[model samples]
Target: MTEDASPRALITGGSRGIGRALAAAFAADGYDLVLVARNEERLEAVARELECGYGVDVTTVSADLTDPDALEEVYERATAGGAVDVLVNNAAVAVYGPVAETDLEAERDQVRLNVAAPVELTKRFLPAMLERDSGHVVTVASTAGMRPGPFLAGYHASKAYLISFSEGLTEELRGTGVDATVVCPGPVLTGIHERSGRGSRWLERRFMRSPDAVAADSYEGIRAGKAVVVPGLRFRLLPWVSRLLPRPLSRRLARLIIDRGDPLESDR
Candidate 1:
């Protein structure tokens, strides 16, 4: 905590979508922000908007999270302001298509950004929060983590790791002033689908939880000290649906969608 009593939050991929939505939530709560993203122009725009709208200081860090060197720089910049009160691990990438045919380099980059970067950032910032005995770590994962998605294998696996990691941290940090929460949103209207080159309209219709809704739900869960927070009423039934169908049926249905239906076809 800073002497000024203003809390600070550091969010990766804060320029758009869920990251941007969460940023608004934090800013509204009067937390100064450090918004990080690869696009300098977009990051600065978001920073300016939040500062203007919420009347809180905003710092923009433009760097690629997948790059280790850039991450160190991000740490320096984020802490220069003060100890971060909230750390949002919201940046992630989805690599679609058959695993064998996907670009190996892209897949690795996704893993580095989606899985390794959050761990690295937490390692850098979480200890200080623990020492102070006050902070929150919110990961924006997905409901896809609960079940297999054939065309989105890497993305689904990465989200599962996030869910597991956050849930474990939630248990480990109990009684400590810090808490860990993973927000699982099924699908939203976002550039992620287009960027992944696989916007499945059929899937999106199943759960239309907006990024803002996810952020709100995340806050509710975090305040309640919940380990896992699945936003959207419709999406919350996902596990039930997955369980009712046998594993074979669930997998086969996914295969049908990816094969005959081609869920990878971007409706965007």
Candidate 2:
């Protein structure tokens, strides 16, 4: 594609982790980018890196997605340039620990960022895509959405909403030349877990997939018009196995594996 004809992708949470990786993947594929994130410094840095390395146009909008007004500003900036051909809803927050112990405000923030943000952004951008009869919507959900999560209750529930929303949108857009895809990745080696005070280095090293791999797989799946993209063989098998097991058994297993203290805790 020529410079002016190249497709543009608008990615939320594009400053770090899977979002940053997705920006790189799209840049490498000759797509210009509009990166939205809370950290202005980080967003500018990433924008420079992608432009310098891939020779693709890059735009950055710094805003906290959890805030409705700030999110609207991001939407305005994203569409000001032109209609985005691809919208990647990757911004999310996780509040870890038992429901009773976790702060309700934090949980609410998680829901706002994880659930509402994507829905609002999708609603705003999808119309233009449908009008043009061409576009892709990619939501970054999680494997935790497949079943109940005891400790990270709110986060899991929010992700479940995203999974359902993405699938429904995909079906709705069937013949509109627009595609919607949800990427469910098991434990990724991102700062999200650490920042949320959930999981451990040992578990992450043992089970987590790299952000780059997850982004690459998600991008490829979206391009192919897949409704769901679950990275890693283990994770891809999780939903099926969870469905085969009894609900109570599945919940018990999840609690034992995820809610319990870290494996290295005993040693420490």
Q: Rate the local accuracy (lDDT) of all candidates.
A: 0.84, 0.87
lDDT tens readout by residue for model 2, 157-202: 9999999999999899988889999999998877675577765546
**Clashing residue pairs for model 2:** none
Which candidate number would show the highest lDDT if scored against the true structure? 2
Q: Which is the leading candidate under TM-score? A: 2
lDDT of 1 by residue, 125-215 (tens): 9999999999988888988888787888888889989989998988999889898989888776555766777655565546555677778
Candidate 1 runs further than 4 Å off: 257-268
TM-score of 1: 0.93
